[model samples]
Target: MQELQNVVSTAFANIVASGAIEKAVEEKLQKTITDAIDSELRSYSDFGKIIGERIKQSLQINFDTLGLPGYNELILKIVSQQLEANMSSALTEHIQERMAELLAPAPSAIELSALVTEFIKLETERAGHTPTSDEFTLIVKRDTSIRSMRFEYVYLDPDAYKSEYQCKYQIRIVDGVVSNVTFNEVDPSKKLFIGRLYGFERRLFQLYAAGTELILDDETKEISTYYPHCD
Candidate 1:
């Protein structure tokens, strides 16, 4: 009987050492946790709805403590107002500047003398001539009866070493402005007198001979002649 009891005790010790019971318990606990999670997931939409309702109720209860509009709405409103204010200020400034320009007086006749002087300089330069201050003379004549002005200038070509080549300009001005400046005649033989000019300068003179208008900018002091479909 004692041997039988010892044999039974040894069998129990072996079963415990094999860890079957502990493994079964662990498996059961894991299965229980998985099933619980699956069930909760199946009802997750409903759970979220309920939680969202509770949170909305809490916010409503504390509405007075917080602001009327939410933080996002308030920030958006502030940003919108600032943008509108900036745009309005810019528009106002632009309108004022335009109005001032519209109300400004026309440039005076004296201011136009500079235009004549520039014309003479550009023409002389185009003719391959640089005249000293003493070698050139400008005569401006205003005819109020015809509402026109005439500019006459004579210059001695500095490039001519063999003989003094005297160049002359007669510019007509109407309405206190001049748009087109051209030679009295387009003599291909004049190239011989002026020597070879740059290709661009030759083209410019050709266009002037062809009756293209010369565009002048008073602000930038730029002179350009118009050529169709050309820069």
Candidate 2:
């Protein structure tokens, strides 16, 4: 019974020894793995820095070989040129349009004799008098400062076989509107005779006072007496 007890004790001691050896090996392996991981971690920052520098140098070399500006400079130059081109095109177009408008021809003036004849007819009719053919001449003068016009009419002979007469009229224009008109007979001595021959003075004043547009040609002494006319 003693021998059986000793054998059992030896078996237990062997089992303990084996277990201790396995624990020691496991601890050594864990320490070695931790050290290796730490070393790799410590080198990661330097590896990243070396790679970054190499990439930077390679980019710089490529830019120099291609004779190209830096990215930032290139982008700025492109943007500036684009803006300048657009502005120049727009300005040129604007100037061209303005020059075209300025170079266009002005409207032609109305014929003189035709306007005077029409005016005489309308005025005499309004005054309840039959229009008669009378020889007359018109002299036009322009005032640029006041934007006004003056007209002088000399009648060759009275239709009623009376003395000759002269009439003058002044028209003031403001902002394309006929603001005021003045009429006078030059020969007051022949007033009664002029009145009897053509009662057109009062009618002329009325026609202009009622918002009539008068287009006159200073160069040719002609006037436009019709509506739907241009200045």
Candidate 3:
């Protein structure tokens, strides 16, 4: 009887082990779960991409409709060019009006300019030559025009010297064109003065040619700077 019981128990164990009643294996179940999770995670990734694209579209539409500040540099440059092109004539007129307003000196300033002009002319005539910097004691003490803008005018008479300032310049401008520039500073010794006069005349002619607008370069930059105009 003991042997039969052992035999039956052994047979039952063998059958169970041989997969007559199979159950899910741990490794296979784990693998299935992992695959499902991976699929779900991939879908989530796609969903995130969709959300990002939607956000981008929404922002672009808002920017266009509300005129918000996207492409700010490009927009500003294009608009400036358009404005300048379309309103060239009107812009010139507008600029001229503004310049007139801004450049309109006070009554006192105008009076001072007139007096200085008269004084210089009278002094030159009285002295029979342009006055030296030291001789215009009152003007020298009061204003720096003589020192600052001396290059704009003929050379000063130094210690009653006449020949040094004798060279004369004749410049004619019509319709903003330098039709003629005549000067007697032909001697090699006076070439430096001629060069200076050339620069001055170039500026004067360019200012007239530009007419309410300016072309920026090394030569014309000072026109934009704040300089004390003796005139």
Candidate 4:
């Protein structure tokens, strides 16, 4: 066993000294991993073309017909109404379904920008002076349960937050009306603070709004976050 170990060690040492291991790693892994990383970093930019193609193929409606996205639903409704008479009800309903399912979802990445804007707006209001994006930063975290109540006014119960964040809040978020989701009469317990929520379609997210000292710098400390893949 001792002799065998020595022989194996000597062989490994020779392989290392000859640069075979380094050559093998570079040839096999390094370029592949670098490429994978590059692709992942660029994936966000591809979202537009991929989604545009999907909408174009599925809806067969040119976005050039409807201008910006803000009035898309309204404009689509009018366009659909105009074209509805030409098409069957079944086809009309299918387009509506596609609109609801695909186009209605505003991904969390979009909301992150909006969240920063909202924060800046509020900070400006509170301090009576406007601060630059460099003034303060946001800390986003995936919340399994409702943890931050400072921003979430109605969702006070930590125990019920799990059920609401998972179930009821999910329902209210339909059609991407994420300005500030409030539970009026449907479920008294389930309401979402738009400021607190920094989430994708299904997952729940919360930004640190209460006590954490906000210092803005993407160049310095990369904000720690757990974001699920956009579905």
Candidate 5:
């Protein structure tokens, strides 16, 4: 396996040489090939020259096509959406097969959130971007076993496009298992949050009207929740 330092330094070199960052840094802000990389990776000098070219090649292609200025923001939005869609399709297929094998009779409720998280893991593998864990807060509720839930949300960069949007969605979950997932942004409205959701969607999950945390017991399948308004 390639060391992390070599990979990053190579990636930086490619970025600089590709003209992505070059336009941003002029003569006054000149940076050496070594200075472009972080010091922490200095010790890994052995791997730098050998693996650097591979890293540079891979990074240059994407930066050349997707980086700001190189490509319009709208195009980047489309690329992101397509990638998300591909990831979602792949995730859904894996989840379906895995769930069948794991649950013989099939569980009563599959948490969509849990399944979605799992799908994201798989999708990240396929995309081969820097492996990163998904980080976004999600809240859901259901009176009965959740049949399925889908989450969609969008984020917009106001400066990029006055009329564009980014959209994402999570799919089919019984109880709470997420069966499918995707992340995408597009040029759309100014809305900070927007998306489609199905299967027992809640603005927020409140254990009680009194506004309290809800605790669940795995063994008993019992829930103890409190809401502030109830009190």
Candidate 6:
């Protein structure tokens, strides 16, 4: 269980360093999130019945209505792509609007931050353990105009023992492709970037040409975070 917690923490950190994500596990998380958001959107739209019918009708017949690969499956696979390659305030507003449809109005930044922090804390508590000091300072950036994400988490004990992770993701909507992704770090240096990029090339195309964008979510949560942004 401790290993799983570490893996989860490391996984998020890897996403921060390399703007890329996998299609499998990401979907599971998104499903829960989407369900909540969808309820909110439905309430706001006031056309919940109609919209629900549309969702069922659209998806029940035409496979394309489901969205890429397999609709739900594709959403899991491509959500990170959207985060890395096509992020923007407009996207955030749109999502917020969707949330408003079924849930209460969007939470303020402070409220959102508190919610996120509590959620993470709850996860740690559920595991019957505590996140290390550095794990408390997680950072996440999402940009909609270009769609991508970058995030990091670090743990440095008072004795100077340290563990860190970073991940970055880039998505290309034009071709429905992931252009680049890299994660994991020990002693970071310039040379490390090359190896990270090389590993990404195995799965993506022309990743070297892209410049990553990291847009902080003002609503992010924190606990004992070292960075002002995380705090």
Query: Which candidate leads in lDDT?
Result: 2
lDDT by residue (123-223, candidate 1, tens digit) is: 45565544433233333444555434443222222122212123333334444343233233334434444434342234334433343332223442232
Native-referenced Cα lDDT, model 3: 0.42
Candidate 3, residues 116-200: lDDT per residue as tens digits? 3443454444435543333331111122355533112222222233442352333233322333434444332234323332322
* Candidate 6 residue-wise lDDT, 1-231, digit = tens: 999999999999999667556655688789989987787677356577777777878777666774547578778778877876677777788777644432333222223234334435444444344444433434343334543543332122211123333222222222222223333332222342333222222222232233222223444443344422335
* lDDT by residue for model 5 (3-43), tens: 88889999999998899775766642655545656443554
Question: For each candidate, what TM-score against the reference?
Answer: 0.23, 0.26, 0.19, 0.18, 0.18, 0.19
Scored by TM-score, the top model is 2
Ranking by lDDT: 2, 1, 3, 6, 4, 5
User: Model 1, 177: alpha-carbon shift in Å?
Assistant: 10
lDDT for model 1, please: 0.47
RMSD score of candidate 2 (Å): 21.5
Per-residue lDDT of candidate 2, residues 114-215 (tens digit): 446655454545544432433333444444554354433222211333332343444444444445544454332234333322344443444443544445
1 or 3: which has the higher lDDT?
Answer: 1
Clashes of 5: 29
Least well predicted 10-residue stretch by lDDT in candidate 6: 152-161
Clashes of each: 0, 0, 0, 0, 29, 45
lDDT for model 6: 0.42
- State the RMSD for candidate 5: 37.5
Candidate 1 wrong stretches, greater than 4 Å: 1-8, 44-231
RMSD, every candidate, angstroms: 21.6, 21.5, 18.5, 37.8, 37.5, 45.9
